[model samples]
Every structure is written in C-alpha cells, then in structure tokens.
Target: MTIALEHPVLHSTAIALPARFQASYTTRLVAVGVDKRPSDFWLETAGTPQAGDVVIARVTAINNHKRVETPESRKAILFEGVLVMLAYGHRYAADQFLAHVPEDLGPCHLVAAGGIAGTVTALHDRVDEPTEIEPLGLLTNARGTVNVRDFAAFDNPLKVEAPNKRAQVIAVLGTSMNSGKSTTLACLVNGLAAAGQKVAAGKITGTGAGNDRMIYHDAGAHSVIDFTDFGYPTTFKLNFAEIRALSVNMINVLADSGADTVIVEIADGIYQGETSRLLRDQVFQEAVDHVVFSAVDALGAKAGVQELQAAGLHVAAASGVMTASPLATAEAAAVLEVPVVPTFDLTNPEIVTAVLTDHA
Candidate 1:
C-alpha cells in the first residue's frame, strides 16, 4: 500500500509514532461517539478503536485544493505520500462518509481539506470527485497504538477571560460556506488597517484550517486566530457550551490584543448548526456590535437578514457573491432595506465607516 509521511498536523503536535504500521477502518466508531474527546481514543495495533483515531495513510489521487499544510505554514503537494488525518464520521454540506469503515484496505475520499478521513457520498457538480487515499496503517507507538489527538496542538481550553469591555466587534456571518465570509473579513481588515485602525481577525467556528487566518493576516489584520487554536480538528457537532465559551474567549483574545476593532468570521450559513445556535445566544449576541451578512444570492441575502432579525440581531449591511451582480444586489437591497456592499466597497474605509456610523 502507498504511504503518506507528510502532513502539517503531525509537526504541530507532540504525538510520535513508528514510521509505519497496519491500517484498518474505524469510521463507525467515530460517528457513534461524536461527543467523545479526541484524546480519549485508543490507538493500538490491535484493539477496539473508534473514530477520531489518527492513522497514517497514503494518497492515491489528488483533486481540489490539492496541497496540504506543511510545518512551515507553506503548501506542499499531496501526491502519493504518507499523512496523518482525523477519522471524520460526520456529514458535510458537500460530501459525507460511509457509516462503517471498509473491511479491507481500499480507496476512500478526503472529505475535508482539514484532512478528515471518509468516503464521499456526494459531490457538488462544480467540483471534481474528492482526492482518494489508502489508509496504510495506524501509526503505532511503543505501546502499539496511534491517535490523532496525541499530536493535536491547542488541545486545551483557552485560558483567556472574557473582556470586561470588548472592542467593537464586526462579525461576519454568511448564508453558506464559501459564500464570501472570509473575503469580506479580509476586506474589512485591509480597509480598517489602511485607515490606521488596529484590526484583529478571528474565525470563531468551522473545521481546523489555516487558510482563512492566512488571508486575514495578508489583508493586514494585526492578529489572527481560529478554533484550531483551541484544539479542534473540526467544530462539527461540537457541544453548545464549549462552542459558546470558545466564541467568548476568541473575542476576549482579540480585544485584549490591543485591537480597536475586531472582525470575527462565523463559518457556514446563519442557519447552520453552530451558527444558528450561536446567533440565538445572549452572550454571543451581546459581544457583537455590528453584524455583516453575506450570501450567494438575493433570496439567501433576504433570508439571512430575516434569520438574524428573528434572533433579535440587527444586520449592519449585506455583502457577498450576490453583491457581485448589480441586479441581485439591487433586489437584495430592496428586500433587506439595507445597503448591499460589493466586495470592492468592503475595502473602502469610508464605506465601512459609514455603515458602522449609521448603525451606531
């Protein structure tokens, strides 16, 4: 079987294992015990193991976002090499995994860029099928078991206290993943920084990945962070309490980092599992001074605004792919009764300043 020896997750953690070992399927275990902590799994050459178990696997194919994170924060080719990834048991908006692991060594899909191991159940028409890989074996230790959580970085509660007074929080919420939340945040950061304001950016939810944070940094954010900084491979189906605490701590960190303004990106649609629940939380709502809504289309824009309004949150303005089309922006602006700012205007400090000033 092919072997993948390069993955950023391994270098980020202290978990060490033999160069190689036997491979098997335990996706069902991860699915059933979704609530279990990552460190609680048994990574052995022989034992009853569950999902979230770290395993060394070899890439048999490549597709979208065909590069993996390297230890130096650079992207590396993911063709035919050994890598460590989390055994993901949950469904995604794009693809999903089989309920049980395959009985024998075979091909499976990389369901997420964060290195979630699973079989693809479906695909969006725009993208090709997922990259395929073969689980070579569990990277065993002297005790003969390997676990992904062992090498996981930031696998502990954030030690920050909620700020007594938070800097103005400009939160970016979207209609769906890839609907332009990160881009909007980047534009906001770039513009605010250009205007001589200290901007701290954060991704409060979603799978662990450094791409969004990198974008924010490049856009001139004074500092950037994500849920991965708190030890989660992906935030899918995470408990409400932990997720809420994470949001609070994230804001606190940015606020305390000497930021005058903080732009936090909330992943997925406003109605998405974590996003929806978070919007409804008093603590979460109280931390935000302004809400920037993003959507792919006019209908989505209207619906997003209505969702937030229903949750007693006021939207500052609308922006995203829908704003890319003048007709769609006009329609959404009429429906939302709010300005529909295009991506370009998002980088205009005056435009953002007016939006905040008008709302303030």
Candidate 2:
C-alpha cells in the first residue's frame, strides 16, 4: 500500500504510504485550478517547508480534530496510520490553535480540519491538543514541489482600482471570530438574490475552509470564492500589502463575474493584525462602497461601528449574534446610530436592499 520513490542520497527507494489517500478540503480548489493530480512525491528531509507546500502525512494520533474534511466537504473520520494529504500553512485562530509550517518535514499537527499541517505554538484554553501527523513526503510533479500557489486562480498581480463600476461592493466586517459575519453575508446574498440582483461573494481572509464558500453558494450567490482559490491555506501572517492586493484581486474577479453586487467578508475580528491594518488602509477603505459590521453583543456592536467610522469607512448597518436576543438588539439600537438588522430582517429583500440603497 506504500508508494516507492528513489531517494537521491543513500540509494533509498521506498517509503510506506496508505493505499488510498484522503485528500483534504483545502486541496479541492487546487485540484480544480491545476486540472490534474500530482503524479510524484519525494521526502525533502533537508529543505525548509513553505506555506502551501502539499504534504502527504500519516495520522499519528487523533485529538481535537478527529476528522479531516475531504475535497468533497465530507468530514471523514481519521484513524491512526491513515495517510492524509494536507498543505503546510500558518494558522491564527483565537479560539483554537496558533500554528506555523514546520522548518522541516518532521512530525506536526493537523491544525485545521481544512487540511493544514503545522506545528502548534499555542492553543486556546478550551481547545484540546491538535491531531498529530508525521509527514511522509511533499507531493510533486514535473515542475517541482506542489504548492497551492502553483495552481492559484489569481496568480497575476492586480492593480488596485476604484470599486468596479458595474458592481456595488459591500464588505462585511466582524468584531471577532464567530461573530456571525458569514451568516450576515449569506443572508445579504439571499436577500439580494431574492430581489433579483445577481450576487457574487468572496471570503478574502481566514483559514482555508469550505463552510463559508458553501454557505454563500447555498444562499444564492451566483459566484463564490475565497483565499483558497488564490492558493493560500490561511491568511494568518500575511502582510498588509499582500492582503490589500488580495482584496483588490478578489473584488475585481467577483465584479467581473457579471454580478451587479459583490459582498465580501473579511475574516477574523477588527482587532486582528491584518484586519486592523486593512481597516485603516486607504486602499481598502476606498475599495468598498459600504460596510456591514457584525458583532456578538451590544457593546461590541457599538464599539465596532465607532471604530469602522473612525477608520473613514461607511458603516451601513450592524448585525450578528446580538440580533438573536431582542433585549440585546434593543440595547444596540438604543446606543448605535446604525440600524441593528436581525438575521430574519436581513433575509427580507426590501429591508436588506434598503440598507444598501440608503448607504449608497
């Protein structure tokens, strides 16, 4: 069940591998972009591993992430000794593990169910230890090491421009992770589509996962994409310039999809490293026409709106977990100048469209 590859040194020619490989969800978009599977692999014992380098590793233990999301989005249960195809990447999750790609192809953890392999540097108090894996080799082809960047959809450099003339860009920002950003965005997409508006969406940041992309598609988005489409397994330690360029490219690509409106979500919270810089950057502020802020509570909603306003970005409305509680919604509405739109109201075409139109 193991594939044999000749090692350049010591004349070694074999390594144990699973007979059937379980491709991770992060590889889904890459597969589509590359149009073919990797035909070869080699154990790079000496070279440093880079973000997005595809690795085939054997699961050494199961812990927090007991399952790996497959390319098909199925949560496939993992067992010790099973081989998983994942990409090396850095991760920044406030409620989970903080991880980075290893310097060498040694043992690491499956930091994300989305198929990211990295060494955990820190973990949230509530989060269990990450699943462990021993990398077997880097997946490769005729060109060399197979990195997600090799199959990126937006490989070309993009020049930042005004928001597309044909599309109105509405960006959704959150107070923090799990603040209902994706839900708000999906609801907005549904509402817009219900009103007969062609809607396209993208998640320009965050770890590579299929959940948000799937939600967008199910919510009636005519076109959907995320960081994964651009070859990033996660946008954890990316710089402001890199993130800004990504934003421009994502917006441009979504706009070109013929949608009249584009709704993009910025992953993580406003205070996160890249998110904070992006909010303050003139380029990002000018790229989007309006912004919807999502937060978990009234205080967060108020403070988030104020921060967005201070950043020279238009605050269209506020929504998120706080809307689920009538008292919380009332409290937010009492102090905030922006409308506190509930998830239900967000789905109402008239209400959602009015929010956008009023901000427009």
Candidate 1 structure lDDT: 0.67
lDDT of 1 by residue, 145-250 (tens): 4444444433445343445665889899988877888998999898888778999999988755667888999999988877656545566666788788888888
lDDT tens per residue, model 2, 1-360: 122233333225334333456788887655553333323444443456899988888999899999888777788899999887888999999989899988888899999999999999999999999999998787655576779888777763646655546788999999999999999999999999999999999999999888899999999999998988888889988766788889988988999999999999998899999999988888787788899999999999999999999989998999998999999999999999988899768888999989988766
Q: Which segments of model 1 are wrong by more than 4 Å? A: 1-43, 47-52, 61-65, 81-91, 95-107, 139-163
Q: Give the TM-score of candidate 2.
A: 0.93
My TM-score estimates for the predictions, one after another, are 0.78, 0.93
Top lDDT hit: 2
